[model samples]
Target chain A: MRNRSILIISLPLLIATLLVVMSLSITLGSASVDWQTVWRVIFSKITVINQWVEPDWADTTETIVWDLRMPRVIQGAIVGSALALAGAIYQGVLRNPLADPFILGVSSGASFGAALVFALGWQIMWLGQFTLPVVAFLFGFGSLMLVYFLARVGNKVRMETIILAGVVVQAFIGACLSLVMALANEQLQTIVFWMMGSLSLTEWSYNYVVFPIIAIIAIISLFFARELNMLSLGEEIAHHSGVSVSRTRFYLLILASVMTGAAVSVSGAIGFVGLVVPHIVRLIVGADYRLILPLSIIGGAIFLVGADTFARTILAPREIPLGVVTAFLGAPFFAYLLRRAKREYF
Target chain B: MLTISNVYKHLERKQLLNEVSFNVGNGRCVGLIGPNGAGKSTLVKLISGLEEPSGGTIKIMGKDIRQWSVKKLAQKVSVLTQDGLSPYPISVFDAVLMGRYPHLSFFQREGKRDIQRVEEVLEFTGLADFRDQMLDTLSGGERQRVAIAKAMVQEPELLLLDEPTTYLDIGYQMNVLNLVKDWQERESLTVLMVLHDLNLAAQYCDELILMDEGSIVKRGTSEEVISAQMLKEVYHASPEIVRHPKLNIPQILL
Candidate 1:
């Protein structure tokens, strides 16, 4: 209700922007391909009418479009949306503007899992490139549970305690990860590369795990958007206003943690996508989560897909780390928002 | 419509409310006056179901407070605290519309009737002009009016005001109190307010309940409870208590 046109007009526009970004990213790789060929490749493969537009493009071109670029762009979009949605939920539930997906120990926990996998060299290729992700997902979920239990006092989870627990857990897990890295000699670069985040090697299977969790949680979060608005006011007012404060907080925390876990487990830590995207949506629309939640979903996809595109082609074959590109763009945009919102935003 | 029988509240090492038994009749405006930390706000919280008392029974409309779900209790009771609503980037209309949160079910959006109620309350509270303005841009008086408007839209049988006038000046205090008084009479609403201004309490409240430490010290009309002796004993002060010329109720001359 804060802004109707945001949902009516801005939402579709963001979705359109996402589509364009996805297609453009699919075409802008080191092996350059024209729009027609990319569309032919996508349409033919998606429709299962392979004979419709085949025998024209190279095998390498088809592989680049369908196998490599398609999965990478699509995964980037989903991961971005998941992280940003988690970020918005975190900020709203905690009632803190600076909250992000990694604020809890999920990222560090995932990193620790990856580090252990690398240190032990357990490249079992489980689920065909899913072994490490499954381990990381379990650890990420474990870290969230640990943070929840630590933050809980008797029957309630206070925001300060949650943040404190997150920091404590992150530090502890981060140290463990460093120890694992110290122990590993040959796989240190691989560990560091994964930490930097890249979409160059995204497997199609990551979508199966990340997409459903993100979709279900995002839809449920929309259902609780009004409750989220109440929580932003403060706990007493929220409780007095009829929101079950503890119950609402628990749902949001668990939903955000799972969504964050799924995304970071597969893609490593994509910095600033979660931290910056929700604020961007809030800037364009007002603070109503009805708009912010949906907009952040599309906005995050657009941001990540575009960032990955830039990361992919900026150095041609040698891709820049996705984290570096996100930070380079995100920090300045955030700074600009900060200066402009000095008075207007509160 | 409200009852508290032997309500005792302890916050960790401190006993906040001790044997706090009180009954607010169907359509009465009661004032709770006490020194700081006298458990006034604590009792309000218990009634609103924000916290549970260590021991006791608190009821709204013959039903136990603990028996009411949060949303169900909210349908009958609304609490307003001093500077309660933070200056979030919410429009005045949106902030006031939040009152209908209890009435709407989960996955249920605000209905047309809810919007109508918000509009009515906005117009009633004279916040129609500021409806689209953000909360932070408003003056303290205007913001409190928004909070009252929000409570108005809730349409509760009992309104709990926890030091609702603490942050306002004398003019705003009167404006705010007069609004509540008009609404109380118009709707036969039950209100229990915590007030620091004893004079205002004496003027607006039908009956006054005085608390000190964790126990009720006195309960009567202004003429009965607003004596210099009671002030000295309860407030630890010797301020002169004089009758106001306009309303003929006691006014503290500090």
Candidate 2:
């Protein structure tokens, strides 16, 4: 039996593309900093010795590179990777090609929490500009737990029930969020901005808060790639292949939800990356999650970094929302993928 | 190789398997012959540990099914269903390679030995040529063959098959059964399968277990169990009993 040798060649190329894309996103900004200077400032800010020559750039440029653009780009990468991996996990575990990270009401529940905060006007900045995200994570996680419990029949949690429960919870919570938006007067604009999903406000400290949560989840998810493959075959078959279906499902769903909640909390339901990147990766590669998981991680980072760059740069000082950019870029690319490919992607 | 001292399964308000007790000897190709809703598939489910019996126990290789960890049990037992794994982006080689799932530990990739085993099984099942083809392109018979190849790679001691040939054409059905018979004879594999075709079941299985209304109607050789009188009593429809031209086994005429 011959395995697909494509993964070996593609993985390295994809990773190299991610590096270049991350660098290009950093370089494309208004600072007029060359790619070489971006590296120099990046090096100087980190290293204590100051290395070689006095930098030609101003202090404000360094602050712009290190403080603003750098965090935003890295935040895009982190949130993108987390959401894409979450989508892959959901698709594998639920055996639904349409499954996304937020298919289970995480966004609506999260937005409800954020909308509540906006309604009450509580901007405490609890963890260096992370007050809203933290509260949103808590409520998003609560909704996932509720959906889990609601979907349980006897001891088993079937995929159909999970989707149904998600639909119910999302519709119910989305209505509540709209109600919050309606009744509020002064904070409506802030709530609307948060709902549109932006990474502009992310700073060095926000990365410090979110990076570990996502990295840990991603590594743990990679370890379960084989299990995910077995799971996608269907539950009864997974049992025949030696997986404890319910238990593995419990762990995988939690892992996906944690990462999804973390992503949504940080960047207010950044859709399309989670929904589209995994599908594109699966189209390019085969159905194996061992390849899909890691490749989605890299592909997602590149995509979001590139999208965020365009989001900030395309409109110049007036910046489009990140979610709008992702939808615009992702939808047509996916449509092209559907029209061109003769082979079955799913 | 497999033991069922006394097992009872209740799905809803009714008992699916009522005080059922049977033991399958090692290397024996035993056929479960029954009408619809007769608990044949339910028994397979119990042995595979997908659902537990309400009252009794099932043991494979002398250890209780409940006591075995999922991976350990899977290494020893493989279950093949009616609708084989199909219509996915996975190739024949990868789908067959998934049989090695139970053997590999967490964070472990399939090694040279596992790949070698998959190759051997694919060759044995005559699937080496179809190795790279997408699963959905294969016919129903070929899909079942791929499934058997996967099961063979698992190297299970006990193979539980539920309705192994429900959708296959007669020629394909014989091909599938002949493959199973060959594998069972060569490796002394413990075989238990629910078969819908009475004639094929009678020809392939060593001993026949007849079931009706959730109880054992009779258990014996095909000659003893497939008689016209017993068929009418249990099935409420009589079919003419005849002998196979070549093998002298009892067959049916509807």
TM-score of chain A of each: 0.95, 0.95
Across A82-164, the per-residue lDDT of candidate 1 in tens digits comes to 99999999999987888999998889999899888878977765455787888888899899899999999999889999999
True contacts kept of each: 0.88, 0.77
For residues B1-254, could you state the per-residue lDDT of candidate 2 as single tens digits?
A: 89897798887898898888899998999999988989999998889988888988788888998889888999999999998775676788888988999998887889999989998998899999999888878898999999899899999999998988889998889999999999999999999999988998899999999988778889999988898888788788888888899999998999
lDDT of 1 by residue, B51-155 (tens): 889998998899997888899999999998997788888889988999999999998888899999998988888888999898878888888898899999999
How does model 1 fare in lDDT?
0.88
Say what the interface RMSD of candidate 2 is: 1.2
**Model 2 chain A: ten consecutive residues of lowest lDDT:** A1-10
The alpha-carbon root-mean-square deviation between model 1 and the true structure, to one decimal in Å, is 1.8
Which RMSD values do the candidates have, in order? 1.8, 1.7
What lDDT score is found at residue A95 in candidate 2?
Answer: 83
| Stretches of candidate 1 exceeding 4 Å from the true structure | A47-56, A123-128, A342-344
CAPRI-style docking class of model 2 based on DockQ: medium
lDDT of 2 by residue, A1-346 (tens): 2234666777789888987887788888666667887778877766675677468988887887788778888999999999999999998888888899999888888989989988996777654357788889988998999899999999888899999999999999989998999999988988888888889778777788889999999999999987887777667778899998899999999999999998889888888998899999988777888789999998898889989899999878788889999999999999999888887777
Question: Candidate 2 chain B — worst ten consecutive residues by lDDT sum?
Answer: B83-92
The TM-scores of all predictions, comma-separated, are 0.97, 0.97
TM-score of chain B of 1: 0.98
